[model samples]
Target: MFIEPDYKYMPTTTGISLPSPKGSRFVASCIALTCVLCFVLPSGYSYGSALLCLTCIPLLLWFRPALSLTREDLWILSALVFYVIAHFVIIQYHGSASRYFEEPSRFLLGIFVFLAVIGFKPSERSWWLGLAIGTILGGMVALWQLLQTDLPRAQGFMNAIQFGNLCLLMGCMCLAGLGWAHQQACPRRWVWLLILAAVMGLAASFFSGARGGWVALPFLLGLLYLCFRHRMQRRFLLIGLTLMTALVVTLYLIPQTGVQLRIEQMSSGLGGYMQGTHVDQSIGVRLEMWRAALAVASEKPWMGWGETGYVEPLVQLISDAASRTQVAELDHLHNDILDTLVKRGALGVIALLAVYLMPLIVFARVSLRASPEDYRLRAFSLCGLLLVTGVIMFGFTQAFLRHNSGVTLFAFFMVVLWGYVRLAEPKVHSE
Candidate 1:
């Protein structure tokens, strides 16, 4: 099925040019806009991701440009390759192809997103504007839900954790956008718009009552401080201090917010947990799952129990009926790293670390550069850093990649930012 193109005698007489840059840009913008819209309407988000992938194939072939792979891309590819190999081993050992097919299929989907974004070559401004639009719309929907819903949380169109994490990532992106716009000396109105989006996105995350996003708040602020340290020292200091003060005040006054309660529960559970008592709490349940996961992991330290070997064995290992009941309900170990440890063993954990480490190293390299021409790329790199950190932090309490929103959002934005940065790099060109 794979035909080698004859570069020597490619049909120039046909006069068929590649897709117009304008058309490609339009499609890329639509993809960004739709992704944001899906934050508030996640039922269609998966389908939108699929459509983006489907569209990417013809676009890439028409362009027929050689894809450029950065060092980071190679690293990410290695991690993905390791992941696929582990799954393939599981399939061969277990004689069932379901596990092998499912996760690899998702990775393939991520590859499509990565390829499509790079192929379209969207402008930086267009991509930021699309994200801004999505953030504003998502904020409005969350606000409306806050006012109308009887439930304790305002999750918008998705579950609380997903909505909260989406808002958190968007807020960081908006901040980066504002900083970039400032550096570019863009219109004051556009900067103000980005500020509004950042504020609203943070507000939506707060209203969602998902503390996982809040776990990354300090890291987000730290990144902002680091990014602006040389450029706007005094200004950033004042803003940072004021924001920190306000955050402290908000936490103190809003006893109704679940954050404080969640922390308390975690603290209490930890204390009781260390004393050999199994406390029935959110943190307690995760501890139980983690212990069971480790036990199973020890049984097959090399390649692990695979996807199929998780639940029943863990349940049987739990001596307490109550703990077993709770453990049985879990689809994965709550922690992403731990899940990888349990599913794929030590090698899997190393690969998982590479997945996070490679991107971090890549972005940090660009972000730390002093070139003015690299400002936008640096800003985007910072955004990518914060997004990766937030997801990793969230994964502590939940296996984020196991679900639809987590995988789709992470994969889409991961490539979108990486692709754009590579495209903008003067030394590297897609063609």
Candidate 2:
């Protein structure tokens, strides 16, 4: 019989091939360089590192011209553009253009990193491995910090705020890895290591004593449970509950350590708030600052004083308080929402919402539609959850968007979300 050749049995010449070794190496090096710039750079080094990272954009475009117009890529680009515009507007009105430049530049550099992440089709396994390395590195630094005699000294690449936030985010990442490892059908020794890393990270977070970070923990855990709910078997759920119970017991039993100190501070701060006392301790000053910011916002409802206007406005408002009590240097409002309202008014608020909320919307949509078997989707969903939690919690305590650390984190989350959207796109072939 003149039967057709078995196509399934024959070797196919038309299959889609992965990137070549050289291309993979190039992409890996780019990612590594970006990570170093992010982790190793000093506080104000973002300005220089951002410019260096920007040079990679043309290089990436040259390698993959097809990446220019992807939806995820465009979202990030648009966000950066909006941020830059907002910065310019603040400068035009406030005449402190230089102050906003660093943040905008960091945002732009983050866009380049996001594009680079999309260019490399890293598997979910590979991403976890990369995060694993970062988590371990951060954890070791924190452990060493813990062992030191200096109680209040700032060590490592990040400050107390940055370190605390990084630890919290890294902890979430490690926990996600632990969840994935448990679900995998292979030897899962790495899960234990990840669990240890998470503990260390949490410890570091507490040691750093960033009060806002403590508020972010429950939100992060809740998001994790929600994202992995389907994959959670009955036994897994039972074990999780048991573990949680054990953790609570351990925490309650242990002496004041790590986050316990911050918790105590928060309790005292809440007491001060309820009593309506200006104690200048714990979070009392922050509440006072927020009230002052509100007053400033009321005075300049339309467009506020401008980017750096809060310093003078805040100082003016707190003058009586400073003189009567003993407070010094009321620099920032310490609340992102209030700061934006007082400084940039309604337009700034809109920009801030656009920058943060858009990613949440995109990632939520992707999470809902992603296939159950897809791992990258899972990672993105977890990352999206972390970002939302971080934004909400950190917003209450600090003007996270105004500082380089917060801006950097915001950009990192955007890049991860961009990676997800880019990976989800259907490939087209030219005839």
Candidate 3:
């Protein structure tokens, strides 16, 4: 945990000038390691994070972190609790709901991860190194798979969509972190290396044919600009756009990357869907699933259809419309909002929205008053906002939280960044 919280009476920020807890650096390193472990391993790495959060509980009995919960912090903790309770409420603690409890529990337990950050204040260097190394290696693995295997898309150890979307999200994290890199020793070297890592992460996603996450790009870049506009020259924006355009063109032209084929398939899917010719393609299937999800939600607006309960009625709805019911065969409603609406109903929707919006409220409030010269604070805030935005956008086409990768990465990584924000003590100031 952190510097031993005396939460009853603490300063504005956890920026105390005191020796850190003995062996706290070791604990901090363990925390940082999870960032890399996420991309390198399958579901195994998230266990490490969960373990760290668990480790904090006993330590809390010994001494609190030298920190206090701000208004925003309560919101963070409350959201996690709400998320967990919302799950049990929806399923009535029955069937697959018991097994599905694992994901929601991570959110509730992640409170310790936040507390750990407040106490130990993990080294920023280790965190950045972990991401840079993890993403680069992750990309290499995907590249090897594309070039060597018969599989059309590269998926390290999970679904191609999950693997690719995480890569895309983390890659954007690196890009958003440019300000932090600029402040390091050998600034230019750190900057370029991070840029390269960002490219590798994005490239891996393309190779995986996880085009679903690509929909977030324009908004993601816009957010990055907002976070770092003070530091960027007009010419820098132009250069960035040029590089992004060139990367897209290159990937589309390269046959082995599979980006070209994916784009073509998407175009054809959209073309056929509109013209009403091949209405059973990938896009059409997802579209029909969405329609059915809405119709089904209308049937049971407040208390949703359970995991398996929704299928019969959903199929019946599609049949009544004389539309393809193949989507019922799928496990989830492709959209996260719709999925929650279908299974958990309106209350679940509230819980899910709280998870996304509470964190945004916290980070955006801090960033508003943060000085432009505070690169680390700004970077953390930018990454936080990007995390929320990326997840929401990713959820539009896929129920990302349905997968293990979704819950683990978003819950823990969120607290880690919030911890950094706490360390920075974001407030009105001038350099």
Candidate 4:
């Protein structure tokens, strides 16, 4: 009697062969260099970086011509293209195309570079390892900055918020690395490196004093706990519990440290709310800004005033009500949703939501369908958790989506998610 061949035992090549360890090292170096350029290089590098990213696209295509696009990838690309067109329409009708042209094209280019990287099919595991190495470098830079400063001054290549955001992303990467390392066929040394990376990332976040990071940290931690509650090793669970307890204790005990200071600084803006003095002068400013935005929105509810269009109008509106000194020199609205609403109007908001929510939807679907035995699924789940936390925290006090650091990190994670989803999908068998 002849027995059927074991289907599960068949050896198959990964879609993209794992690049050699040296190649992984080179990729890691590139990631670190990109981070440094984005953070430390002067603002003028924005255009140059876009050019460099454009140069990478054809290189990736040449390297992996067999790359096939998935339905999910198509959805993401379509959403992005639609948003670009929508932005141009709004700029043509209500705003200056020149202002919109300056930053948006670079963001779109960054997205292209990111997707190209994802498409390159380097060993699925190598991408996580590379990201972990990049996170280690970023963490070290942040820690060095913290050591050099006595007060909460922005250091390194980015602003305080951006630094904090990087720390937050690094922390997430570290967690994913830990999961990846555990599942790898590598020796003990790689595990040690991942453990070191995770600790360093957490420490960097503690030192950065970014209030937005403070808000995001717990959410990510909670997500990890929920995801791993059932299948994690007992020692791992114990370590996680201890870390959570220590974090809580630290939060209660350390009143003047890290994120606490930033929170206090923001609260200072609300000082008048607590004391009766200058209540109208303090909290009144943001309130007035919100009211002015609403008034503008009512006037052009469909098309919006366009990018930066609200500045002159907002300045004029505030100058009329109070002393020149009282009016805040406004940038984008402090609120992300409100900023989008003012800049893009109703259609812009829909576009913004599509950009933000698509990843969450995609990640959730992937996580639900992922195999219990697959390590890539765990990494994807961890990334999804971090993205959710970052989005919620950013909603409170940041317009991260509009800023360079935020946009770059967002694009990077999008590519990571795309790569993991591709790796997770079951391949078709050919007879």
The C-alpha lDDT values of all candidates are 0.69, 0.61, 0.78, 0.60
User: Candidate 1, residues 247-287: lDDT per residue as tens digits?
Assistant: 65685367654456656766787887777576556666778
Model 2 stretches astray by more than 4 angstroms: 1-20, 30-52, 68-73, 120-126, 153-155, 178-187, 244-258, 319-328, 424-431
Candidate 3 error regions (>4 Å): 1-23, 93-96, 319-325, 426-431
**Model 2 per-residue lDDT at 350:** 78
Q: For candidate 4, lDDT tens digit of each residue in 1-431?
A: 11122122222265544223333333333443443444344532243245436555765554442356777777776666666777778778874757565445644665665554444333454445555565666567666666665656444466666666666666665676565567657836666776666665665666666666667777777777766676688897898679756864674367544556555555774685356334345344655666677776776777777876767666666543452245445567656777878877898888777767776677777767767766666676567657755765775566776776666556555654665556556652121
Give the range where candidate 2 is weakest over 10 consecutive residues by summed lDDT: 1-10
Minimum summed lDDT over a 10-residue window in model 3 is located at 1-10
Residue 314 C-alpha lDDT in model 1: 80
RMSD of 4: 6.7
Quickly count the clashes in candidate 2: 0
Per-residue lDDT of 59-140 in model 3, one digit per residue for the tens? Answer: 6555454656778889899999998888877767435647868878889878888887767556666667667767887788
Indicate the residue-level lDDT of 188 in model 4: 62
Q: Point out the higher-scoring one by TM-score: 3 or 4.
A: 3
Output the better candidate (1/3) by lDDT: 3
lDDT of 4: 0.60
Q: lDDT (0-100) at residue 227 of candidate 1?
A: 81
Which clashing pairs does model 1 show?
A: none
Q: Model 2 — TM-score against the truth?
A: 0.82
Better of 3 and 4 by lDDT: 3
Pairs of colliding residues, candidate 2: none
